[model samples]
Target: MTGDHAARPGMAAPRLALAGWVLFDWAAQPFFSLVQTFGYAPYFVRVMVGDPVAGQAYWGYGTAVAALLIAVLSPTLGAIVDQMGRRKLWIGATGAIYALCCVLLWFCRPGEPGAIVMALAAVCVAAVAIEIAVMVNNAMLPGLVDRSHVGRLSGLGAALGNVGGVVATLLVLTLFVANPGTGKTLLGIAPILGLDGAHQEGARAIGPFSALWFGCFILPLLLFTPDARPIRTGTPTIRAGLSALRASLRELPRHPALLRFLIANMIYTDGLVALFAMGGIFASSILGWTAIQVGLFGMLVTTAGIAGALAGGSLVDRIGARAVVLLTLGLLMAALAGTLSLGPDHVGPWAVAPPRPDRVLFDSAAERVYLAIGTLIGLCSGALLASTRIVLIGLAPPDRLTQFFGLFALSGRVTAFLGPLSVAVATQLMASQRAGIAVLMVFFAVGMALLATVKTR
Candidate 1:
């Protein structure tokens, strides 16, 4: 009811509260890691749709729809939450919707009537709900700890998120998903729940699995994290919130530094999101990977992410978040270039590492090279994501934290549709996944250039 027990500025929060706050990231990550990036997406493209190109395009359009919705609603909702002043309630509401949508994904079976539509709808709604929950949770950060520990906490959250993703991916691979060839899980046994691998039921289980994980893990925050008291309620809150949002929009241009950072964040975050969305599709389509291979790849990348976030978090405190952001952006650009250069039989123009008829898991030199590149991408992505949040927290005004975080979500989502839509259109037109993903390079490059202009303390 009241935030009287919450940590004030210049004071440390209770360790319990900090842990609960950090665990929210842990709670949310399996949806991203398993459903979005590694497990269900690849299965959807390879098995459900049965055509990589069409599936990729469909996935892109679905993601674009989600991004557009988030773009339109996040800022307004953030402003309203600021007026209402109770973030945990909003987080709980959105999280419940997110979990329910995720559960619905279990019903999306191949060849079933309306299956693809159901899948896309569930993904879009879940994405929007989780994204809004994340924005609200992020706003709570400034209130939970003093300025000195913000970067550290941000980094810790990211690292823990990666850890959660890795663990979830492992669980899905070992217990649920089975290899089509052997019809056995990674542990060399039948899927525990009688999941039919032949029908791709194991892969579909990611939805309910993620939902269960979210429900179980999010409890700490609800129980332990302090929430600010409501300042207004009902129709009056809505009216005042709308008026406040209008004022914030008008005054935004006056805060040039925050504006610049938001734009830069917008661009780069688009690139990051597109990369994650497309990465598994690229692997499954180009390299002829299956569920097991993609899951292993997810584990590798997420482990690297854990290392990167932890290191970046510590580095941000010493070298400054801006420097860490710049460094990671450069690294990500290089990784993207490396990723684009790779093919099944060759790295770039040279046709080396030709396909081996008896090839085992990722046996080709090119595949090994790609794995390395993906690890680099994962590392840089973790650092980049954490540092950007630190940068925003550093720049945003203290009183308008939630509103600014809403703007943060808006900026990230506004052009977010463009990233995936461009990829979808390019892939559709060029008939090449490579050409589509290449568009992300422009976003990272332009974002880096714009980021150079922002001043941070």
Candidate 2:
């Protein structure tokens, strides 16, 4: 399709319709924001499993499983969706599965005999479904309009998603999650629906809330975004897609720079994922933070992340994605160091006599230190993600950009399990969540070193 197709007056998709397309991100981020990062994830560690270290390991395993499925299936699914030409069908179907899995999370009560295992399975399935749906949603991008508005549209979409995360964090904090000691929200009231905060029902409620949030916000995309009419349709589409995917894999080795960058990204992005995945549990376990504190902290981090993404977008065009990736990775390394230095008994690696919670928000030296360092992690996470795609695009030949982008996604997925599994194994072996989290630094450092030598042009 010509770039001008979406920009011309007659051909352009309606503005409100386009806005709805961007709303996809706004609709989807609460899963990561509340369920995965801040709310229910911690509840798993603190309550469900009743052991922080074991809970971290179990959580990592779930993520690892999901990443494995995504890596194995995403490329083939993308190819099939392209052949089918009806992205909405896949998006709707996949989305329903994700929502159902999330709603089922309400069953993850602390004392239920199989609740933790069941929750893990639901999470794995839901995460895989979300990734697949996102793949289908992205595949529909070109057909929805044209290239002229793509960058701006994408930026708006991402910003809205980050903002959604912030809002979700705030809502979950004020409405559902209660302080560990007081069993009250920041609003100083009982959880909505009288959820038993004493038994952590309030915390576990993120599952159902995430489901409702996803379902309500995604209506615009389903109603407004246009789907491509299938060229081949159904069974034949899958067969053709498998054949095309096989050929594409055979073609990848000729593009060495793209290959290297993908490998580097695979290593680093997995590490980044692992860190954020463990962030909530780590805070709860080591810092003695309540659900309310974690929620408040998440609100702050998502806000910082949005600022970083905006800043990084400007910088990537000016300084090249390679430089941006290097700079962001460096910031993360430093942040990781700062994060590692903090423990309940210490501030910046200096161990002290048992310091108890005191004063106001982040009153203790350890909490203060962690907050400062964690802000840097938040800043780098969003920025690096924004920059990496541009870097990949810059490395690919214009004629083969689509194939290269697919390979890029494949690279990210192929070893996505490594970081989480490593964390899981490390945590289990050493019985330390910190040790597991610290392993991510190795990946970031390695990726930076690999990225330094890749040719961008």
Candidate 3:
């Protein structure tokens, strides 16, 4: 009836094991931070696709596909892994695929035949692999530390992930990803390694950079972290895994708090995912920011995320995960409203900052407002994500931890496509990126309402 690990309930894992486990987040984050959100995605939309509107739609569709795949497979894999045990092997297998896919992205050069298709395929596969790997990693959490320390560990991991993101973004901006107009990086120097800004080779290098970062950082976890023992010797059979999954599904309704929390997570995580997926593209298309500018903004957001996650983790034990979630959600809604209100010339129809031909980076009032709003969004989002994980740990049965973590991934990803797809559809219908992004507000509001009904102890 206990979580599947050698560590007894309430016993702390060894410090080495704990450090290794926490470092996995640092290892895994660059893929999301650089490739998915800040660096490669914006490049894909802006330069490779060459029309912001069409590119956003295309990117959305691709993200939807990845989310749908994650939704369908995560729970099933969780069940299978629960039967097979030893999460490290699964993590290694998926991490290899994820890393390889990222490296392959270097081939997706603009104007190359089939480059677009190749890029989309690589991204979609990598996304799915990483999400599955993350599910397995999350399953390891309940076993890592005592219940009392769960929130702190989870929050610390998220904070480290943001730190990784910030470092990775900075690296890309400094070493590669030059401003096309000036042929310079953020540091006023040409991109190192002869990376041509005109050919966008610098931007394309984000893929390989992320891959290298992941490969290097993941080794600590594999080398030092202890994995759960196998439930039984040898490979687990598909039939047995299916039976276990069915049993878990049938038993779900008995835990009303867990179910409600999952549902709420399902709704809100979609909004969060969509927001992350679109944020860079929105900046490029709506704000007319260049890749370097977007990367800088990403650094700002990620720096804020680190602070928020650390604070949230600290508050979880004191205020409770539920309170942290609620507070962060409220903050997220307000920040999102502020985000949707701003444009190049105006903030919520005031027309305050007109276009200045002589303007430098982030000089206008509108841009400044956006930077402030984005900081808040970053803070609230990091807290929201970490708190939600703690909420799941609080609500799930100790015995069924891995199976439920799978369900947790399912809940987070099941309707994930709807978030991106709705944004794509709304953007197409309204021909306005702002209108499309505004759709996420509804997801946040509905999730808050649903979360309120769950009675967390």
Candidate 4:
């Protein structure tokens, strides 16, 4: 469990350990892709709140609260990791928080007093816990691979995560969430678990299902991945953790490149967060897509994401992390603008002269165009996140990798609430979801400008 053991490049065990580490990404994504982004989240907006526009605004407001808390705590915990010389223990602790919150999502009900508030609370807790777990997991990266290969491994993790998302979303769409009209799954079969469509169990099951999936998949990492040896600091672990964090904060001014990268990450990562958090709601409200159609959309997006992560990783090894990030951000900006332009029957001034209101599920030309635009978002999002981590790793001092990675979360969270909160405010002000979503463009544009100034290795 020492640093040397963590760095050792053994033949058989390292491969297995890497696989186990990657499996973590796989196990963790369903909370996001299925439960958070594409599945249960939409249910909250449509069924729980009962008004798409207001639901979206409130959802964003709740997410902002969670993001603010996570932003404040992630770096503190990371600083502790550097002192403790351990990652897995913190990961387990946070993983428990995440999985429990997810399982508790089952308690969400329709029309009860404070039902919406309780659901938002579960979402807030789950979001915070998952984010903490992710940062802790990233801190473990240096233990898994050499510096030269970090980009590829990061890319592989992103790709595998998307693969897991695709599978999880598909399973829920086909097995658990029955079609709203027909009360049958995508397979045209009766809902499994005798899912009470009356009480919306079919959709609600996504919570416990995601919890089970995460617990099962994280085992590979817990069982096989290497951990740093226990260090014997003279002070308590909490005291040492605080001192380490304080010292890192004081020394940050000496690192201009790292400083710039964090600023850029804070802006753009917020934009990315807003995109995923609200994408499903956008589709459900504007496109009128049910869980089945939404699941299909998730599959397509995740599949594209897998390709984007791999391609971005290859480019990171050749061109540079900075270049990859800039490219991805540009694509994301364009994709989002296109998405914002389209509504049910209109596309930013180009109206479908003959609007097909009679048709079901993405029947309009604008809807089809929106679907096409989502593919671009899917492709760029995976690459944007994968390469951003590589950029931070390159800029950070090797001795302080975990501490710096924690700052990465801090960077993302610092303004994380701002993006969604602004969207919430905008949606409320304009009374239009499209205009509210358009606010993300400001984050991306500012982020790209800051990213351009960083010097690459």
Top candidate when judged by lDDT against the true structure = 1
Q: How many clashes (backbone atoms < 3 Å, residues ≥3 apart in a chain or on different chains) does model 4 have? A: 1
Tell me which of candidates 1 and 4 scores higher on TM-score: 1
Q: lDDT per model, in order?
A: 0.86, 0.84, 0.85, 0.82
TM-score of each: 0.91, 0.95, 0.90, 0.90
The residue-by-residue lDDT of candidate 4 on 1-457, one tens digit each, is 3223365653223787888888989989998888778888789988999898899999999889999998778777766666777678777888888888888778877888888998899889988888888877877776678766876787688778878988888888788988777788888887898897545677789988998999999987887888777675546876877887777678789999999989999899999889888998998898778777777887888888777777887888888899999999999889888897777667889878433544566667886787788788887887877788889878999898866876676777777888889889999999999888999999999999999999967
Reference-based lDDT, residue 256, model 3: 89
Quick one: RMSD of model 4?
A: 3.1
What's the TM for model 1? Answer: 0.91
Best by TM-score: 2
Alpha-carbon deviation at 291 in model 1, angstroms: 1.0
Local accuracy of candidate 3 as per-residue lDDT tens digits, 314-364:
899899999999888888888888888888888997988664655688888
Model 3: residue 324 alpha-carbon error in angstroms: 3.8
On the 0 to 100 scale, the lDDT of residue 332 in model 4 is 87
After superposition, the stretches of candidate 2 with alpha carbons farther than 4 Å from their true spots are: 1-10, 351-359
Candidate 2 residue-wise lDDT, 1-457, digit = tens: 1112223433657776687678888878998888888888888888889898999999999999999999889988888877877677788899999999998899877788899889999989999999898888777666556676677777888889889988888888888888766777888888888887677777778888888888988888777766677578778889999998888888878888887898899899899888888887889898878888888788878888888888888898899889999999999988888777788788665776454554466677788777777778878887898899999888888988888888887888888988999999999999998899889899999999999989887
- What is the per-residue lDDT of model 1 for residues 1-457, given as tens digits with 9 covering 90 to 100? 2233457778877787888899999999999999988999999888878889999999999998999898888877877887788889889999999999999988888888888989989999999999999988988888888877886898788778878898889999999999887788889899888998767688999999999999999988888888876788888888887888787678789789999999899888988899999999999898888798899999998888777776787899999999899888888888888888888888988888765655688888888988998899888887887678789888988787766766776788787888888889888998888888888888889999999998887
For model 3, the run of ten residues with the poorest summed lDDT: 1-10
Model 4 scores worst on lDDT over the 10 consecutive residues at: 2-11
Cα misplacement distance, residue 405 of candidate 1 (Å) = 5.4
- The superposed Cα distance between candidate 4 and the true structure at residue 346, in angstroms, equals 1.5
